[model samples]
Target: MKLYSYFRSSSAYRVRIALNHKQIPYEYIPVHLLKDGGEQKTSAYGKINSKHEVPVLEDKNVRLSQSVAIFLYLDRANLNNPLFPKAFPDFEKCFELVELINSGIQPLQNLAVLKKLKKDFEINDEQKVQWIKDIIRNGLLAYSKKISDEGPYSMGTELTAADMFLIPQLYNAHRYEIDFTGLEKLLQIERTCLMLDSFKTAHPDIQPDSV
Candidate 1:
């Protein structure tokens, strides 16, 4: 197994955490997203993932691009620690939280959208920061309400793909200095999850290509 990743990419970071949690060993191929005008834009990497994104996983005869797809693959292929719930509302609930970050907030705040805003809309840095803060604040508040009351992990006692989706978003929050003021639930979740070795190993700062 091999993973093509970019240090500091929230998508890749989550995949790393999942890999570590499952105790799966794989080669880490670093794709520098920022150097030389973004290596992911190059034709070579483009063929690997036409979407021009990191967190691409190649295992046996299969290759995957999206983080959620990779998570699904890893969960089934490994069979050791399942990332999704086996039951009804729990399964739907997990996906609800995943989609909340996967599509709702992540896409809006990703590097591609920020670049588009600066180039086309001519938005300044302050405008970009404010836009990020407003979106994150609203989304996180909703997350605080949606998460289970069972404590620790997002879905309660067990860590699911929802937490995988979440930890990275919180990392981005800190990256942009977004305020955590009223969101004690999320703060507590972050504190609890980070205490685990899986999250520790997958952190952006410790990656081979981190700079």
Candidate 2:
């Protein structure tokens, strides 16, 4: 198995944490997203992933894009550590958290979207930063209200894939200097998750391609 990743990408960071937590071994291929006018946009990478995004997992003959799909595949393929309950409401609940971050927060403020805002609508740095801050704050606020308080993890005693999603989004939140004065629950979760080896090794600061 192989993972194509870009350091500082929140989406890729989630997958890294999941892979480490599951103790799955895979070769790391760093795809420099910003180097040489964006490496992901190159003709070469396009052949591998038409979307030109990171967190693309290649195992045997199956190549997958999108972090949620890759994570679900990883969980099913390696059944020892399940990320969520297999039953009805419990399973559905986990996906709700995943989509909260995956769709609600991540897509609106990712690199491509930010650049598009600048290029197409001509938004300036101040506007772009504010845009990011608003999305992070709103999404995190909703998450803080929805999650179980019994946790160091979002879903309670077990560290589900929600933590995998939350940690990276928190990293980005801190990266952009988003204020967390009212988000105490999220702060506690971040503090608790960093104590784990999985999240620590998966952090952007420790990645080989970090610069």
Candidate 3:
């Protein structure tokens, strides 16, 4: 198995946490996104993932994109620890968290959007930061209310793809200097993730290409 990843990408970070949680060993092929004005845009990497995104997983001669799908695939292939709930309702609840992260938080604050604001809209740094904060604040606030019923983790005690998604978004929050205090449940979730080794090892600072 192999993971084509960028060190600072939140999406890639999500998959890294999942791999670590399952104790799945794979070779890491670093795709330096910033060098030469983002390597993910190069023709070479684009052929592997038409979407031109990081965290593409190649296993059993199958190349997969999207972090949640990759997590489910690895969980099924390894069959060691279950990342998603098996019971019908419980499983749906887990997926609810995944949707909240994937659809809610990720799209608004991704690097591509940030860059577009600067390049296309000519938004200054402060404005860009404010835009990011506004979007993330709304999404996280709603998530805090919705996921309140769950335990320390996103959906329950067990770590799911949602938790994997949360840590990286929180890191993005910190990167933008966004204040998370308004979202208490999110703060609790981030605190809990900090205590886990999977998040620790997958952090951008420890990655090979991180500055």
Candidate 4:
């Protein structure tokens, strides 16, 4: 197995956490997103992933893109450390947290969207930061409300994909200095998740290509 990834990418970070949690050993191939006109846009990488995105997993003959899909694929392929808790009541509840980060918050605040805002809208750095903060703040608040004082993890005691999604988003939040005034639950979840070795090893700062 191999993973083509960018260290700073939240989506790639999600996959890294999942991989680590499952204890799946794979070669890490770094694709610099901002070096020399972005390596992901190059024809070579483009052929690997039509979308020219990071976090593309290559397992034998299969190549997969998208973090959520990769997480599901990894979960299905490996039964040892399942990403989703089979015994949990209403699996959708756990997925709700994952979707909140993966679909709702992540896409809006990702590097691609930020670059588009700057290039297309001609938004200044200050405006861009404010826009990102507002969107993230609102989304995080909504996500926070979903956690019913569940203590450690998002769903419950056992870590799930929701925690995998949360750690990277929180990393992004901290990068932009997004306000976490009333997000104690989410903050607590982040704190707890980071305590685990899987999350610690998957962190961007420690990755091979983090700059």
**Model 1, residue pairs in steric clash:** none
Ranking by lDDT: 1, 2, 4, 3
Report every candidate's CA lDDT. 0.92, 0.91, 0.83, 0.89
For 1-211, candidate 1 gives per-residue lDDT tens digits of 8999987999999899999999999899999988999999999999999999998999999999999999999988999888899899898999999999988898998889999999999999999999998888788889889998878889999889999889999999998899898888898999999999999999999999999
Off by over 4 Å in 4: 87-89
lDDT per residue for candidate 4 within 148-196, as digits (tens), equals 5756788777788888988898898999998889988888888888899
Error of 2 at 134 (Å): 0.4
Task: Please list the residue runs of candidate 3 whose C-alpha ends up more than 4 Å from where it truly belongs after superposition.
Answer: none
Off by over 4 Å in 2: none
Candidate 3, run of 10 with poorest lDDT? 141-150
lDDT of 4 at 40: 95
